[model samples]
Target: MSNNTNKILTALAAGIAIGGILGILFAPDKGENTRKKIADNSKKLSDSILDTVKEGKNKISGLKHNLRDRAESLKESVEEFAS
Candidate 1:
């Protein structure tokens, strides 16, 4: 699940970066303005990526806790059955 999430996030980031670059290239703005726009867009993209990573981390942590609990429950059930 983590791997799948990472793949999705990576694809999303790639798409955003590609779209931003294309937009910047096609814009008719002056050099300085274009550079600034690119910088701003890059910053925004970075922030979005960071947020996605944080969210993924939280989800993974929750999954880990749930799996641990399930494993504990299974272990207890096995021990009772064997007694």
Candidate 2:
């Protein structure tokens, strides 16, 4: 993924975390309920971010392998031509 895409994802994750916390804090629920809600939301948010990062890491790894393959092919062609 592009840097812009990574930045956007990071921002989105941060926004979700901040928004969820603020909403829970301002809610009129009991302390135990509020804590539970916070824990659930935090777990959800962390899972989402972890998934996205893993996806991005896989994409980048694939791209790296592809580029290496292409570069090796080009090098072989150049060596054949120079011989």
Q: How does each model score on TM-score?
A: 0.82, 0.77
Worst 10 residues of 1 by lDDT: 1-10
Model 2: runs farther than 4 Å from truth? 1-12
Clashing pairs in 1: none
> In candidate 2, which residue pairs clash?
none
Top of the candidates by TM-score:
1
Q: lDDT per residue, candidate 1, 1-83, as tens digits?
A: 56887798899899989899889979898989988998999999999899878887888899999999999999999999999
- Report the C-alpha lDDT of model 2 over 1-77, residue by residue, as the tens digit: 78898789989999989999999999999999999999999999899899889988998999999999999999999
